[model samples]
Target: MTMLTIDNLVKTYAGEASRRAKSRSGTDRTAVANAAPARVFAVNDVSLEVGDGEMFTLLGPSGCGKTTTLRSVAGLERPDSGRIAVGERILFDGDGSRTTNVPANQRGLGMVFQSYAIWPHMTVFDNVAFPLQVRKRSARPGKREIQERVAKVLETMELGHLADRQATKLSGGQQQRLALARAIVIEPPLMLLDEPLSNLDAKLRESLRYELKRLQRELGITSIYVTHDQIEALALSTTIAVMKEGNVLQTGRPREVYERPNCRFVAEFIGTSNFLRGTVASREGDLVDVDTDAGRIRLESPVRVPVGEEVIAAVRPECFEISRTGWGNRPNEWSGTVTNRAFLGDAVDHIVRVGQGSIRVRGNPAISIEPGTEVHLATDPAKVTLVPVG
Candidate 1:
């Protein structure tokens, strides 16, 4: 079942016009005689469907409209035009003729912002119980019911023992969990998270990532997560929608987007990739041969590129195998000098100078090599991705 659906969503904001104009002679003028106001599409015509019990993420860079899209769904930001629905309920509908908008409090969705947003004056128990108590008399749960629900949620979040502690006295991680406890105490059908773990320390953030995942699975709550961090998106999302310039470029599972990026931007944004530009030399089935600037390279790609057509091969650092001696009779082996190396705790990253280009190779830390030493690099053809030229 579809938990949430956004159809042709668009949100625009008025922006400043150009400060200067070009003259006939190509000289910049102080100001333009008349310039039209800029219309910035914060959320362009984006349509999406989030499945039940799935963690869907809006992944993009800053100012790329991810937060705007999420706010629109939460009813915090009124979109210029679009329709938002949860199951059969219409939360928002706006298109020229008809208009329907639900207030944020009535949307029945849980949201956790970047900040913990905990009330310093309240105890942990009251913080989580506040939402249940504020409801209308007809809809409100009884006092005992609210107590049981709040206690259950706090225990699930591992904050039960701290229920009597002042909200301001909790550690960063505990405070974050308290915020989550308050949100889930209502047991909303859809949860909206906007970079909830970003403010925590690295270790705590990592630990909470798995904790959030476990909570989502055990509680069976469908969630929409927004973040600019690629690793966080990859680690937590069941489905990822990659956004750029107010538009979504691609949506797929984590491994699909990482291993087979649809475009250059996705390949570059999702993670670090070494690109080699070249023209297609030959093709046999899924195998393709490209003559690049560094050397002739072969790769396997399902996308067909005609002979002589320009293309790029994107390879991740971990795909390459580095060694001191050459692997005899290897298919895609090249000898290069190690210009630099970094020990990343569990692994080593070596920057190998291959001809005029440099390729980064990540491998086991035990196989570390000194800089200025010559090393051979080899990668499987299937590991190299052939991206189309824009």
Candidate 2:
């Protein structure tokens, strides 16, 4: 079932004009008065659907409009145009003839923001039960029911033991979980998590990240998560929408987006990649052959690039096999001198210079080679990815 649908959701902000702009040559008093300020389309023609019980993530760097899109869905930011619906409930419809919009509170969504918004004066138990206590009398649960619900939610969040403790007394990670506990107690149809783990330390973030995933799985809640961290998105998302400059560039499974990016932006953004300028040599079924300055390489790709077309061959450092001896008669085998080496505890990174190009190869720690040593590099055809040129 489609739990959430957003169609042509657009949000824009007018650019702030400078006070000195009125004195500029082209902008006289009349020109300044009549001029229409520039508009920044924060979310431009954004449309997507989230399946029931799916953890869909909106991923992008800062200022990419991901947060804006999430806020629009939460009814916190009113979009300039478009329609947003959760299941059959029309939360927002910006059509001129007929207008329909449900306020944020009436939408009944569970939201955990970046900040841990726990009440300082309240105890953990009261914090979780407040949402229920504040409900309208007819809709509110009885005192006994609220206590049972809050207790279960606290235990699920692993904060039950600290229920009587003041909210300010808990640690950072605990406070964050308390915020989530409060949200989950409501049992809302959808959950909106905006960088919930961003403020924690690295280790705590990783631990809470897996815990969040486990809770989401156990509860089976449909969620829309927004984050800029690549690893976090890959670790937790069922689907990821890569956004840039107020538009969604691509959406796919974690491994699909990482291993086979359709464009250069996706390839470079998802992970580190060595881009080799090349031209298509030939096409055979699902395979494509390209000739680069380093050597001839083959890639397994569904994207069709005509022969003789200029393209880029992208490969991850770990995908390349680095050896001291040459593997004769194999395609994509190149000999180069190791320019530098870095020993990362579990893996070793080697930078090799081959025909005016530097190819980075990462391998097991046992394969570390010193600078100035000769090395041979080879990779499987399926490992190479063909990315479209600008």
| TM-score leader | 2
Candidate 2 segments whose C-alpha is farther than 4 A from its true place = 18-33
State the weakest 10-residue window (summed lDDT) of model 2: 18-27
lDDT of 1 by residue, 1-390 (tens): 899999999999876444223332233343343445467899999999999999999999999999999999999999999899999999999985879999999998999999999999999999999999999899899999999999999999999999999999999999999999999999999999999999999999999999999998899999999999999999999999999989999999999999989889999999988899999999999999888866778899999789999999999999999989898987788899999999999999999999889999998999889999999988899999998788
| Tens digits of lDDT, candidate 2, 108-206 | 999999998889999999999999999999999999999999999999999999999999999999999999999999999999999999999999999
Poorly placed runs, candidate 1 (over 4 Å): 18-36
Clashing pairs in 2: none
Query: Model 1 — which ten-residue stretch has the worst lDDT?
Result: 19-28
Candidates in order, TM-scores: namely 0.94, 0.95
